[model samples]
Target: MLAGKRILLIIGGGIAAYKSLDLIRRLRERGAAVTPVLTRAGAEFVTPLSVSALAGEKVFTDLFDLTDEAEMGHIQLSRSADLVVVAPATADLMAKMAHGHANDLASTLLMATDTQVLIAPAMNVRMWEHPATRRNLAQLLADGIRVVGPNAGDMACGEYGPGRLSEPLEIVAAIETALGQGSLTGKRILVTSGPTHEPIDPVRYIANRSSGAQGTAIAHALAALGAHVIFVTGPADVPPPQGVQVVRIETAQQMLQAVEAALPADAAVFAAAVADWRVASSSGSKIKKDAGRLPVLEFAENPDILATVSQRKADRPGLVVGFAAETDDVIANATAKRARKGCDWIVANDVSPATGIMGGTENAVHLITAHGREDWPRMSKQDVAARLATRIAQALG
Candidate 1:
């Protein structure tokens, strides 16, 4: 899809700038031309020579380059690309982009560009979570700017949170979505991911080992196929995919409400590992460790989100899919779940500790349908998501 496309690549100042080199190679390998624009501060991390070598073109810098400015180079450069991508979009650059500060070449080009823009943010965890950055992110999304990641991981600063630049392939996928090519074009899909936290006390909760990798991958695949995605996620270890409307929740009840609110979609995928039960009356304050005698806790069954959505009579999606993560009787239990939930399909998997499928990268699953079951080989979560997305597109058609 990217063949012959022109990508205006802007390198921002951050440790993640090194990833931009890999990004250029990935884009070029897929037949996209990259034009590199390095910020003055960005040059501190990645030299202009390396960027020029990867892009096989002259690097653009300095707003006052008399040679290029004589012909209004900035405007021409901005308008010439099919898409504008900013890797390692630092806090300063994001702030500049948000408030329309055009003192530098990179920000000036971003201000002048009419092409669709996608950014992969990278920064310290604190900076990324700051109110100012959050406000800027909101503004950018509101302006239709696409965002990929600042995926949570250990950072160069020895702190860990959501500030690492997305891997090169992930950025490539986001670029594909931004470019608007896919089988599920014009479709809107809902995906729920992660393990819901059922609060038992102010600081404790019932949860699972779900990392939400599969669900995140499914959302990414759907978006790459040109689907509008409403991602309702619990406290997921992984960040939500790019190009989706994210709704974060902490409990099954909240997840259900979020799903209902984002209803009237073309399809829905329930991949969250919601807690089956919660404390009937959780303490508002932290439960003291030395509270004399052992406190007895009453448990209440959590709401069944998948069943509610699947059984909805109004605003029901054309396709409703549920997941069955079992440690025993994987096939029998999942088949029974399909019959019980009334969902169109159930993706069954053995998430037994022995299988290591719960929080692992690879998954072996069974596709259970009204017709029959298809035993699939163990594969990476991303491959499974892509396959399922293709099936969904066919089903929708």
Candidate 2:
């Protein structure tokens, strides 16, 4: 999709800088040429030789290299590529870019470049959430720079939250979205993913076994088709996709609120495995386990987000797709679910332990719709996403 594209990749200083090597391979696989510029601190983690080897081009490092300057001026270097991408765009690098500082070759090229810029930020959780970093991010976005990921998870510092760099494929998807011809352009879609956590106390909760790989793939596929996506996700094993607005939530109720806030979408896909019940009167503190006494737990039904959105009286989406994770009578169960929930379509899959579909990489799904059911062959989750996204585009049209 990115054939003939020339990408100038700027590797910033962060532990996530190592992923930049893999990003080069992904970009080159899609027929884009990568020209890498490594920062001083970035060189600390990865050697220039490795970057050059993977990118298949000489790595540029210094602003005052007389020989390199004679070969290609900074102005020429900055504007030479079709796109400028900064992977592991550290806080310092972003601050410099936001303020147009050019102390180093990376910042200098970023400032002097006339081409479009995309950054994938990586820092500690605290740094990423800091006011200074927030200001820099806002400024960068306001200046028309595209961003990919700083996914929330366990960090290298034993801290957890949003600050990790996106995976290689996610970054590549972002690059494709930035450069590819729009297929679902101007369309807005809402997608929910992962397993919601229903808190029972300060230290415990209820969740599911959803790996979130399928939903993440779907979001990426839709984004690749040029649709503006609102991704409302819960605590998932896999990180969310790139190039979409991600709203993280913990409970089903919060997911409903976030989904409602992203209103009037063209379609809504409920891929998340939300808990059906929550603690009615969860203890404020952890419930102590007694040797002989048993504790009573009361449960209440959680919000049915798919049903609520599908049965909306006003401003309902043109297409509302829901998933049925059934172990037996998949088609019958999903068909019944479609009619009962008032959704336009239902994606049914057998998640039995024998099939290993719950947390596996592949899926065998039956798409149930008003017209009838279509049984798709077993395929990778990514393939399933692509086919479903294409069908959605056709349906919306």
Candidate 3:
């Protein structure tokens, strides 16, 4: 996927700088040409000779190297690559990138670059969790810089949280995503995930068993395909995917409002297991137990987000996909549901306890459309998401 790509790699100072060498090898193996820029602190960890040898390209170090500037101006070098990648992006580096500080050659190139930037942060757990880091992360995201990972695990700093740089292959995957020329590039996609909570009291609420694994995977797949995804998610078992516009909501009504707010997209996928009903008269406080006293709860139908969006009179999405989690008559029920909901397609799955699909890692589903129904073999949720994303790409194309 990364063939013939030009990547300008900036190695930041950290214990994780060693991994950047391996990253260069991985990128080269996939036919990507990497230009190395080693920071002064990064040089303390990895030698310029090593980086140059692995990258098969001259290493750029000094900001004012007369020979380098004569051969290729800093501005030219920065604008030459398709993408810029910062590996072992330490706290100092992230803050600089976030705040636009260009004191050194690497930071200067980062500031001058017109291309997309991807950073793999590596720092102490406490530094990673600090308020300043959080603020910088938010700023970077807002500035359209893609972040790979600071995966949670034991750190070299003897602190454990989220400060480990992603593995070489994981960084490669992120690079591929950044440089992909997929069909969904520049497309806007809306995706809803997880189960909604309908509150009955201050502490009590009703919800489904949706783990949101499938929806999260779908959002990741869409983003990997280069779609600008608007992810509307509810309280979920797993964390949401990176590199997407995430909108968190708690209830079906909130989900609906969020979905509507993210309108005029090329596609919308309603993967959330929204409740069918909510308490008509929810209690403000906890109900006390008393002898011969009973509390009756009335039910009201929740807003059908899928149906409403699909049947919109204006600014409807080009493609609207809904999910049907049925235990019996799966295909038949889903086929009817697709028509009833007025969606372009319905992905139906057997969520019975025997299948272990609901809240499970794998899924077996039927794709229902106006054309017909196609039964898909059981596969990991990630596989399903990739397939669905590809299908969406094809449909949009």
Candidate 1: the clashing residue pairs are none
Per-residue alpha-carbon lDDT of candidate 2 for residues 1-397, written as tens digits (9 for 90 to 100): 5789999999998889999999999899879999999999999999999999998999999999998789667888899898999999999999999898989899999989999899999999999999999999999999999898778789889999999998777677577666643668999999999999998999999888999889998999898889999999999999999899999999999999999999999998999999999999889999999999998889999999999999997879999999999989898999999999999999999999999889888899999999999998786687678668877877887
Task: lDDT for model 3, please.
Answer: 0.91
Please report the TM-score between candidate 2 and the true structure: 0.57
Per-residue error (Å), model 2, residue 133: 36
Residue lDDT tens for model 1, 263-379:
999999999999999999999998887656787899999999889988999898999999999999999999999999999999999988999898998899999999999997786
Residue 6 in candidate 1 has what lDDT?
96
Error of 2 at 333 (Å): 0.5
Position 224, candidate 1: lDDT: 82
In model 3, which runs have C-alpha deviations exceeding 4 angstroms? 185-210, 220-397
Please, what is the TM-score per model? Answer: 0.59, 0.57, 0.59
Ranking by TM-score: 1, 3, 2
Pairs that clash in candidate 2: none
- Model 3 Cα lDDT, one tens digit per residue, 1-397: 5679899999999899999999999899979999999999999999999999999999999999998789657898899998999998999999999899999999999999999999999999999999999999999999999898878789776888889998776687677666653668889999999999999998899999999999999999898898999999999999999999999999999999999999999999999999999998889999776889887889999999999999997889999999999999998899999999999999999999999999998899899999998887786686678668867877998
lDDT of each: 0.91, 0.90, 0.91
